[model samples]
Target: MQPIGTTLKQIRQAKGFTQKDVYGDIISRSFAIRLESGQHDLTAGKLFLILDRLGVSANEFRFIQNDYQATASELARSQIMLAYDQQNFPRISHLATRYAHSDNPAERQMAVLANVLIMAFDRREMVATPAMAQLWQQLTLTKTWTLQEIDFGPIILVLTVQKKQPLAATIRKYHLACERYVSAEADPFHVMDARAAFDLVALQLLLNHQQYATAQQFKSQLLAGETAHFTSDGNLDQQLSLWIWEGYFGDPTVAANRAEALRQIPSTRFKLGIDTLLSTWNKRAAAYHQRQK
Candidate 1:
C-alpha cells in the first residue's frame, strides 16, 4: 500500500482541493505538507478527520490506495459479514466501533446492525434501550435503506419483536421492499443471493415470535417469486434455518429429517448472529407438536 499521506495528497489534488482547503482547521498547512511528503504520520483519529474533510471515506481512500477501485462501503460490509460468519466477536466489535463512528450514515447503520446482531446471537435480553429505540425510529423513518442496508431490516425486526414493539405490518413492508430490491438487481446471482439472505432473515424473525402465519406468507411469496433459485446451494445458515421453518409450519416429517441433517453439520457453518435463532428454532421444533395437540 502506498503511504496514506501520498494517497491523501493524490485524492486531494484530484478533487482540486488546495492544501489550505483540505487542511481547513483539521491540520496545519505545514502538517499537511509534511504528511504528504511522508515526513510525519498522524494518529488514526486525526487521519480519519483529515480524510473526512477531504470528502473521501477511509474505506474509499484505502481502496484507492491499494488500487482495488471497488466500492469501499461494500468491501467493509462484506468483511463485517464474514466476521459474523466466522464468529469472530473481537473483529466484529472492532469493525462495529470503526463504522459506528463513521461520518457515513450507511456505515453507521451497518454498525448498529452488527451490534444488535451480536446481542441477539448472545441471547441478551432485549429491552427497549434508548439506543435501540433511536435506531428503530431512524430505520423506520429513513427511506435510504438499499442493497446492503436492506439486510439491516431483519436485525431491526428481531429487535422490535423482542422488545415487544408493534411492527408486524412494518415487517411485511420491509419484506416487500426486499422483493423490489431483488427485482431491480441486474445480475441474477445477486438477485438470488439477496433473496435467499432476505428470506432467511425474515423467516427467522417471524418464527422467533411464533408468527407462523406471517412466516408462511413470506415463504409462499418467496417460493412463488424465486422458487427455482431457492436451493441448498444458498447460504448454509439460511438453508438450515429455512429447513427448520419448514418443519415448524410445514410437514413435521420433512422438518425433522432436515433438522436431523442440520444437526449432523458442524455449528461452525452458521453465522454467529444466527446461532441463538438456530438454537431457539430447534427448541421450538421440539415443542411444536405438543402445542399443536
Candidate 2:
C-alpha cells in the first residue's frame, strides 16, 4: 500500500501535475499529500477515480506498484507449470495446500485445478471432488465471467463426465465461456489456441456422450475461428484433431484437407506416423457419429 502511494507520487511528479490538479476536489490538498506520502488510504472507488485522473488503469498501477513483478495469479500459474514439468508432485501438493486455505476465491479455485492436474499426471481416475463441485457451483452461479473462470471449461467438463453429473450447469459454463472467448484476455494467437483447445475438448466430450447437436455447435465455433497457421507440434496436433472432428460433424471435404494440413508440420515426436494417427482419429470420429444413425 505504501508502495502504491509512493509510486503514485512519483508518477504525479513525473507527469508534471501539481497534487491539486490531479486530486482537485476529490479530497483536500493536505489529505492528498498524506495519501501520496503513504500516510493514508483511499477507498477503491476513490483510488480508481484518482488513477483515471492520473491516466493509469488499475492494471498499470499494479505493474508499476509491484516494480514490474508478475501478479499473484500469474506467479501461481508459473509455479504450477514449473512444478508439473519437473514431475514435482510434492511441490504442487504444497501449492494446493497453501492456496486451498487462501481467503481469495481465485486461489481456492486454482488449488482445485492444481489437484486435478496432479491426478491426471498420476493416471489416477479423475473425480469431481468437493472442491471441484464448489468451483462448478461458483462458476455456474456467477453473474459474469472473468478470463480465468471462462478458462475452466475443460476441467469442469472432465469432472462432469467422470461424476456422470447433470449437464445443465456444465453446459451453461461452456456456453458462457464460448461467449467470453470472443474477447479473450490473452494475446490474439494464444487466445485462439486456448479457445481451440477448449472447444475441441468440449466437442469431444459432447460427441462421446453422443450429444451431436451440442457437438455441431462447437464444430461451427471451431470453423469460424479456424486457421492454417500453427506455431508448435501441439498446435498442429490440436488442428489435426479438430479436422478429424470436422469430418464427423462438419463438411467431409474440409476434414479431408487435414492430410494436406499434416504436411505443414515437418514431423512429430511420436513413433506412429502423423498420417496414421490422424487416420485413426478420423475413423474414430466417424464411428462415434455413426451411432446417431
Candidate 3:
C-alpha cells in the first residue's frame, strides 16, 4: 500500500503548495505538517478538502496511489474484455451481474453488451430479459455511439445474426451515421481498430447466415496480400471456426487436423479454449467420417 501522507506531500510539492498554503482556510499549518509527516491522521473529509485544493479527484488520487498503471474503472473494463475473449461464461455472467447496476455509465453499457453476448452464446430460444430488451432498443434507436460501443460492433453483429434478430438492415442503414461518431482521424490506432471491427463483423455476419461463398470472398479480401495483416487471436478463432464449418459436412478431418496443429503450437492464442474446442470438433468430425464410411 502507498503511504497516503507521503503521497499527499509529493503532490503538494509538485503543485508548489507549502503547508501554510494548503491549510490556510482549513487547518493550522502545524496540523498540515503533522499530517504530511504521518504524525497525525487525516480524516476523509479533510483529505477531500485538501485534494480539492490540489485539483485532484479521489479517483485520481487512487490512480496515483496505485502507481498509475490503470484507473480502477479501466482495470474493470480490461477484466471484462479478457473474460469475454476467453469465453468464460461464468466469469462473464459474474461480471455482467456486477456491472449491470454500476453507477458508472461505461460499466453499465458494458454490462448490457455482456448480457447480449451471453444470450447469443447460449443460443437459446428464450426471450431476452426485459433489461436487455430495453438496452438493445436504446442502441437501435440511434446510430451515434461511443467508440467503446462501436468496438462492440463485431460481437453484436455476430449475435444478431445468430439470433436471427433482423438487424442487418438497420446496421447497413445507419452505417454512415455510425461513421460520423468516430473521432479516429487524429489517432491512426483508432482508425485501424474501427476498420478491423467493421470488417470482422461484416464477415462474421455473412458466415453466421451460412453465406459461405460470400464469407469466403470477404476472407479473400482480408487475406489479399499478407494474411498476417489480421493477426489478432480473436480473428484467428473466427477463421478456424469458419474452417470447421466449411469442412464439417464433407471432410471435417481437414479442419480438425488444422485445429490440432494450431493447438499443439506453444505460441497459439486462446490456447486452452481453442484446444478444447478443436478437440471436440475433431471427435465429431471423426464420427461423421465413420458414419459416412
Candidate 4:
C-alpha cells in the first residue's frame, strides 16, 4: 500500500487540486503540508472536508482508512513484542495507540488487551490508559470469546510473581468463562473450541514464564499420557509444550531426546524451530545463572 502521504497526494492530483486548493480556506497551507507529510493529525471532520473538496468519494476514503488501520495493527504488534522482550512496559503502554487506530477491530482489541496483560504479568504499575480501559470494558460487556483472551488472564497472573501460587482473581474470571462454554456440552466441534481456548492459555502461561517443571506436571495431568499422542498429531500446542520442557529441563541427553522427537514429525508438516529456540534459551539461561553467581 502507498504511504499516507503518497495516497493523499494522488487523491489531490487526480482531482487537479493543490494542497492550497483543498484546504485553502479551512487549514493553512503550512498545516496541509504537515498533514501530507504525516506530521499532523487530521480529525475525521477535517479529513472529510478535505476529501469533499478534492472530489474523493466516501467509498475511496474507506479503502484508505482500512489500509491505514491494517498498517497500524501490524506495527503495534511488532512494537508490543519488542517492548515485552526488553521489559519496557511503559513503551508497550505507549504503543497501544497504534492498535487503537486499527481498522480490524478484533486485532486492535487483542493488541491492547495483550499489552495490558503483559504489563500486569510483569508486575509493572498498571497504567490503564483510557483506550486500554475502554477496550477492556467493551470485551467484558460484549463477552467476546477468543483463545487469546482465555490465555491472557492466567498467563499474566502466573508471571506476576516468581513462585507458584493460587490463580489470581482475574485468572479465575476467565476460567469461569471457559467453564460456562464447556458446560453447554456443545458439539465436539465446540468442545475442541473450548479446549483450544483453555490449552493455549495454559501453554503460554507455562512457557513464557519458564515454568517448565510446573508445565510438565500440568501436561501430565491434562493429557494423561497422551502427550506423545498429541505430539504425533502434529499439534502446534503439543509441540510448543514439549519444546518448552526439553528446552528447560533437558541436559545433553534431553536435547538428544527432543531432537529425536522432532525427527519423527513430518519435516514438511512441522516447522520445528525448537532447535533454534532451545539454543537461544541455553545461552540466556547460562548467562542468567552466571550473573547470579
Query: Top model by lDDT, which number?
Result: 1
TM-score of each: 0.59, 0.64, 0.54, 0.40
lDDT of 3 by residue, 183-254 (tens): 423332243334444554465445435565555555443432222333465356445545555454435466
The per-residue C-alpha lDDT of model 1 at residue 288 equals 71
lDDT of 1 by residue, 163-249 (tens): 576656655566565566454324333445555665676666666667777776665544545444444535554556568667677
| Candidate 1 Cα lDDT to native | 0.68
TM-score, candidate number 4? 0.40
Among these predicted structures, which one has the highest TM-score? 2
lDDT of 4 by residue, 1-293 (tens): 55455567767876788788888887888877877777877777887787788777665765665663544444455566555534455666666655567688755765655565565445455555565556555545645545455434433343333234433334445545555444333322233333433454555455555555565566443343223323223254455445544544446476557656755655542233444444554664465446547
Q: What are the root-mean-square deviations of the candidates from the true structure over C-alphas?
A: 9.7, 6.2, 9.2, 13.6
lDDT computed for candidate 3: 0.61
What's the lDDT for all of these models? 0.68, 0.67, 0.61, 0.53
Q: Tell me the deviation in Å of residue 144 in model 1.
A: 7.5
For model 2, the local distance difference test gives: 0.67
Clashes of 2: 0
- The sequence of per-residue lDDT tens digits that candidate 2 reaches over residues 159-185 is 676677765456555555545544433
List clashing residue pairs in candidate 1. Answer: none
